[model samples]
Target chain A: MLKPEILDPQGQAVQRALPRLGFEGVSDVRQGKRFELEVDGPVDDAALARIHDLAESFLANTVIEDFTVKVEEMVGEEK
Target chain B: MLKPEILDPQGQAVQRALPRLGFEGVSDVRQGKRFELEVDGPVDDAALARIHDLAESFLANTVIEDFTVKVEEMVGEEK
Candidate 1:
């Protein structure tokens, strides 16, 4: 997940408008991008670290946004 | 988080192109919207349930996409 900085114009706009859309208790609404990745191998610690580096270097723009990388293990047998 | 169905054209396009951008191990890349909401009160169970309802009814378009809602409690003292 990547979110625009709080000072970002887009985020501010969404925050201001959420109350008008019936979200009365909602004070801030910051919209961003979500990237779901399906990896081919085991999601071990090393793999997670690699993905984190990839997210910082390639996936997200660090200038104005922040990102998070989550790794979920596959449930069934690996093929 | 809301993701498009596998048959979605936008998701397909992203999955097809991820490898080209050096995400060799990544088989699928599904893009979607991420919304961060800051509510005015405690993020309790009832607040979460209400947020879920709001997400389904207003934030996400259930016809073609699926959404997940996560609630994180605020850390600082409430004003």
Candidate 2:
């Protein structure tokens, strides 16, 4: 997601359009991109660190955006 | 995010490019949009229902994408 200080024109555009479309009560809106990565192996601390670096260097522009990495689910693992 | 049957070209592009960039072992990647909405009042079930409606009607293209709405964090609320 974009850092608080960065200008998110896309998010601002959405926020402005919402009230006009009858969706009220939302005071603010910020938009960002989300990615789900399926790893071929365990995501250990070292893998997380490398992923962080990858995010900074390739996925997101660190000059404007900040990102968080998380595990969503273990597919077909268990209930 | 896009439905499973939808062709996520953007996600596929990233997946294809990753191995070349030395970030290996990622088997798949899916991309989607995330929004952080700040509501002006307390978030109850009705609010959530309304937000879900908003997401379906405007936030995501229901023909290709499916959306889920959840409250992330409440500002000024006790942790």
Candidate 3:
């Protein structure tokens, strides 16, 4: 779950023009990314490392964009 | 980037009640994850591998939720 923040110039531009678009009460509008993947069962340290590699290589651009990742089991699997 | 897809029960719950929220013309409301990070000059494949680890460890929950990653350089830096 890596999220790269580009200058949401498009989102900002839309946000700015939103008022004219007849949209009111909208505060901020930032664009982001999302992903979902499957592991064998539970993820371990090594598996985590692999996921991060994907984030850096394909998920986010380190130069200007920053990203974050999150992990959890399938829904209802938790007690 | 890796994007994990959870049931989005919350989002669905909200979507179900959106009509009552007086927010018409809106179609869907789904939640996602986004990240931004920096690398040396440009990111290599190895770096990416590490990032995915972070995402899996902390950023997302595989149980009921899934996520994705994205990488990109800062804006205007590209020539």
Give me the candidate number with maximum lDDT.
2
Ranking by DockQ: 2, 1, 3
DockQ of each: 0.76, 0.84, 0.08
Give residue B6's lDDT in candidate 2 (0 to 100): 94
Give the per-residue lDDT of model 2 (tens digit) for B15-79: 99999999998888889999988888889999999899999998999999878898878656675
- When sorted by lDDT, best at the front, the candidate numbers are 2, 1, 3
Q: How close is candidate 3 to the true structure, as a TM-score?
A: 0.41
- For B55-76, candidate 3 gives per-residue lDDT tens digits of 5664456666555566766566
Which residue runs does candidate 1 get wrong by more than 4 Å? A1-6, A74-79, B1-14, B75-79
Docking class of 2: high
Instruction: At residue B72, give the lDDT of candidate 3.
Output: 61
- Clashing pairs for predicted structure model 1, backbone only: none
CAPRI level of candidate 1: medium
Off by over 4 Å in 3: A1-6, A20-26, A76-79, B1-79
Off by over 4 Å in 2: A74-79, B74-79
TM accuracy, model 2: 0.89
Going through the candidates in order, what is the number of backbone clashes in each? Answer: 0, 0, 71
Q: What tens-digit string does per-residue lDDT give for candidate 1 at A7-70?
A: 6566567667666776678877777887777887778887788778767876678876788787
